[model samples]
Target chain A: NAGVTQTPKFRILKIGQSMTLQCTQDMNHNYMYWYRQDPGMGLKLIYYSVGAGITDKGEVPNGYNVSRSTTEDFPLRLELAAPSQTSVYFCASSYKSGRSSYNEQFFGPGTRLTVL
Target chain B: AQTVTQSQPEMSVQEAETVTLSCTYDTSESDYYLFWYKQPPSRQMILVIRQEAYKQQNATENRFSVNFQKAAKSFSLKISDSQLGDAAMYFCAYYGKGGATNKLIFGTGTLLAVQP
Candidate 1:
């Protein structure tokens, strides 16, 4: 399986510019997530989706928006890129529901974005 | 909201030796999951090990294992037979049990350096 894949391995955006980070999973998982990792920091959840047509905000969803139209795709949109938004972005997917302690989330390679 | 913490910002170990990275989390929920993910220079989030809150037995995968202390809310990763390939940033994450939208909360991360 290709697992989870994210496009644009690296990108640079001017302040106030907008862009979409693409994520797709071939695992047919119902749960997907978006996270941003700053240098010297862990990761902060941006948005998550339980299934197609359903999405929810996460800990750091203020600057981003997400849409899950199909089971394989969940794209994150940065409305107004800021230097504060510059970080490594990751996409993940899990076959199990959120409440299952046995669930394992598979992650993508990550997209590094820089806002200037 | 749950929070994960990694007290050590950086650590070092000699090859063939053992190193432990400490992690603690705060959550009132009785059922949840924990994980340790390794990110090398390639920027890939690789799952090293996982633990269930209800399981008392520790989880091990080859050279990687975890010490999960439910009462103390502590989870630590031990890497035995450390190798240069093991040098990476390790992240501690938490997943609360049973929700339509299960999200993972991550700590600040620990950078491990394996010395030859």
Candidate 2:
């Protein structure tokens, strides 16, 4: 099913520069999320969308923004990229609604970003 | 706030041996979900196993299994017959279904190395 896909597998950005990481899922899931994993650390949530046109901030929402116009696509925007923002970014989707749905999230290959 | 913690920063095991990676989480919600995600060098977040807090029985998938202790707030992953392919960074995540964010909180991760 091709599952979830992320674009630009890797990227390099200069301080103060801006870029967008693309994410899409073939599964018709209602919940999507953006997370960043730093070296020697676990992932921290950046943003999440419960459904189309619905977005909310997660644990680490600073320096990033997200837009969910369609159920399949949710893009993360990095504004004024800094060295601290350099990390592996992952996009995940799950059918996390209702009490009976699945809570397991399917993740993308991930995008490694380096900000200098 | 809910938090996930992986006490071990790194672990090593020989091929065909068994290794257990420990994970503990702090959450007030009684009903929640837990997961173990493996991130190989390719950086794909692969779900290894899952455990629902409400289910007393442990969850197992082939060589991978989980020990879910609700009272202790602990979830550990046991890998039997460890293969080189099993080497990766394992992350423990907690999902509080009762929370408003409905997001997964991840531990720092344990870097697993399988020696052949």
Candidate 3:
């Protein structure tokens, strides 16, 4: 299995620019998430989807939007990007939640975004 | 709100020695999950180990193990026989159940350097 895959390993956007970070997982996981990591910091969730057609905001969702039209894809759209958006973005997938399920997340190679 | 904290910003260990990275969390939910992730220079978020709130026996994966203290709300990762390849940024994360999406709260992270 390809597990989780993210497109454009690196990207740079100028102020007011917009771009969509693409994510896909072949593991057929029901839970998917988007997280951003600033330099020298841990990751913070931006958005997540429980299943197709179901998406929700996470801890940090400003300046971003997400849609889960399919189980395998969850793309994050950044509108009018700013310098604060410069960070490494990661896409992750995990199994369904349960008392017995540890929800061990499988992550994709992150996309390093630099917004000028 | 749940929060994960990694007090150590950086830690160094001899190639053959063992080192423990500290992590503490605060959560109101009784049923939740904790995780340790390793991000190498390649920027891949790899799951190092995980522990369930209800499990008394700490989680272990090969040379990696977690010291989970439920009462104290602490979760620490121990790397045994550290090697150069073990050098990476380690993050502690918390996931509470019953959320619309299984959102994970992550710590600021600790950079681990395994010196020869």
Candidate 4:
């Protein structure tokens, strides 16, 4: 089963350009997250969705917007791409939450977006 | 706010040897979840292992085990008989137990290299 899928494997956008990174999961998970990894740095959370119709901001939500219209899809939109937004974006999903709740997130092959 | 930290930016180990990647986190909640994810050159984030804050027994997956110290708030990953395939960027993540929407807090990743 395809756990999580992200579109636009790679892209190059000029400053002020706009783009949307698509993410979908077949696992029917309740939690989905978007994160960006910079060179030699850890992944930073950009946004998250608890379930369909529910979305929330994460640690690094600037320059990004997300929509969770369906349980299987969570899309991140870059309204005005900047050089600082150039990074590897990852989408992840998990079944549940809690100390014992697996909480193991299945991640998609990241989208490498370069803002020039 | 909960925060995860990976102090080691890079680490190297000889083939068939063992290497340990350190991780520490801070949170006010007593019950929570911790995880280790590996991102190879492909940029796909893969779950390596997970640990529950309340569990006294450390979690182990094949050759990957965790040294979890609840009091110290440290969760380090130990890879035994390291292989070339194990080379990747490792990230430590945490999730709070009290929230209805569970969100992960990630640490600055540690780059691991296995030398043949």
Candidate 5:
């Protein structure tokens, strides 16, 4: 089974352009997240959803938007792309949060976006 | 807000040898989770191992093991019998338990190189 699938493995856009990065998971996880990884850097959260229709801003959510319309899909939207937005994007999902369980995040193959 | 830190920017190990990657985190909460994720050249983030704050036993996954020190707030990854395919960027992540959204806080990664 494809645990997580992301579309448009690579894309290039001009400054101010907009695009969407699509992510889908077959694990039926309840939590989904969008993160960007810069060169030689760790991932930074952009947006997240605890469940369908429950999106929230993350640490670095200024230039991005997200929607969780279904348990399987959570898409990330980049509006007015900037040079700083040229990074690899990853989507991850996890099961419900609990005190006794370790919330293991399953990640999709990243989407590489380049803004010029 | 919780924060994760990986002090080593790069580490190299000989084939069949073992290597340890260090990670530290800062958080006021008593219960949380720690994880190590590996991102290879293909840019897919894969879970290497995980540890829960309340668990005294360290987590291990085959060749990968974690040294979890709750008092010092450190979670380190140890890779045994390093293989060429093991070279990747390793990220340390933290998650708080019982949060409305269990979002992960990632550290600046450490690039591990396996030398034959």
Candidate 6:
């Protein structure tokens, strides 16, 4: 099902440079999320969306913005990239949230970003 | 606030042996979900196992199983007959039902190494 897919497996950006990380999921999930993982560290949430056109900030949302224009796509845009933003980024999606529904998230193959 | 903690940063076991990775979480919510995710060198996050808080029986998937202790807020993953393919960084995550969006909080992860 190509559960979740990310683009630009690796990238290097300079200070103040901006770029967008692409993510797509064909599983028709209603919840989408973006997370970043630093070396030897756990993942931290950056942004998420409950459905198309509705986005919210997560635990670590600075320097990043996200838009969920469609159910299959959620793109993260990094503005004025900084060293702190250099990390591996993952995109994930899940079905509608419910008490009995299976909420297992499907993750993408991550994009490695290096801000110089 | 929900927090997941993985005390062991790294662990090693001989191939075909069993190894357990410990995890502890803090949450006030009674109904929630717990998960173990594996990230291999390819950088894809894969779901290893999951457990629902209300379930009394441990969740098992082939060679992977979880010992879930609700009272102690502990969830540990056990890899039986460990193989080289099982070597990866494992993360414990928590999802509470309090929020409208199902956000996941991940632990600092434990790196497992299967020695031949």
Candidate with best lDDT: 6
Q: Candidate 4's residue-wise lDDT over B1-116, tens digit each? A: 88888999999999999999999999999989999989888887888999988899999999999999999999999999999999999999998888666667788899999999
Q: Give lDDT tens digits, candidate 5, residues A36-80.
A: 988888888899888899999988999898888899999999888
lDDT of 6 by residue, B61-97 (tens): 9999999999999999999999999999999999887
Candidate 3 per-residue lDDT over residues A1-116, each given as its tens digit: 99999998999999999999999999889999999999988889899888899998888999999999999999999989999999999999998855445557889999999998
| N/CA/C clash count, model 5 | 0
Docking class of 5: medium
Native A-B interface contacts kept, per candidate: 0.88, 0.65, 0.68, 0.60, 0.68, 0.62
Clashing pairs in 3: none
How accurate locally is residue A29 in candidate 1, as Cα lDDT from 0 to 100?
94
Off by over 4 Å in 6: A97-102
How far residue B41's Cα lies from its native spot in candidate 4, in Å, is 0.8
Ranking by DockQ: 1, 6, 5, 2, 3, 4
lDDT of candidate 1 over B1-116, digit per residue (tens): 78999999999999999999999999998988899999999988988998988899999999999999999999999999999999999999998886456677889999999989
Q: Which scores better on lDDT, 2 or 4?
A: 2
In terms of lDDT, the poorest run of 10 residues in model 2 chain A is: A95-104
TM-score of 3: 0.95
- In terms of docking quality, model 6 is medium
Model 4 misplaced stretches (Cα beyond 4 Å): A97-102
* TM-score of each model, in listed order: 0.95, 0.95, 0.95, 0.94, 0.94, 0.97
In the predicted model 1, the residue pairs found to clash are A99-B97, A99-B98
What is every candidate's alpha-carbon RMSD to the true fold?
Answer: 1.4, 1.4, 1.5, 1.7, 1.6, 1.2
Give interface RMSD, per candidate.
1.9, 2.4, 2.4, 2.6, 2.1, 2.1
- Choose 4 or 6, whichever is better by lDDT: 6
Ranking by lDDT: 6, 2, 1, 3, 4, 5
User: Best candidate per TM-score, number?
Assistant: 6
Q: How do the residues A6-84 of candidate 2 rate in per-residue lDDT, one tens digit apiece?
A: 9989999999999999999999999999999999999999999999999999888999999999999999999899999
Error of 1 at A94 (Å): 1.2
Per-residue lDDT tens digits for candidate 4, residues A1-116, read: 98899999999999999999999999999999998988888788899888899999988899899999999999999999999999999999998854345556788999999999
Query: In model 3, what lDDT does residue A32 have?
Result: 95
Question: Highest DockQ: which candidate?
Answer: 1
Instruction: For residues A1-116, write the lDDT of model 6, one tens digit per residue.
Output: 88899998999999999999999999999999999999999999999998999999999998899998899999999989999999999999999766445577889999999999
TM-score of chain B of each: 0.97, 0.97, 0.98, 0.98, 0.98, 0.99
Clashing pairs in 2: none
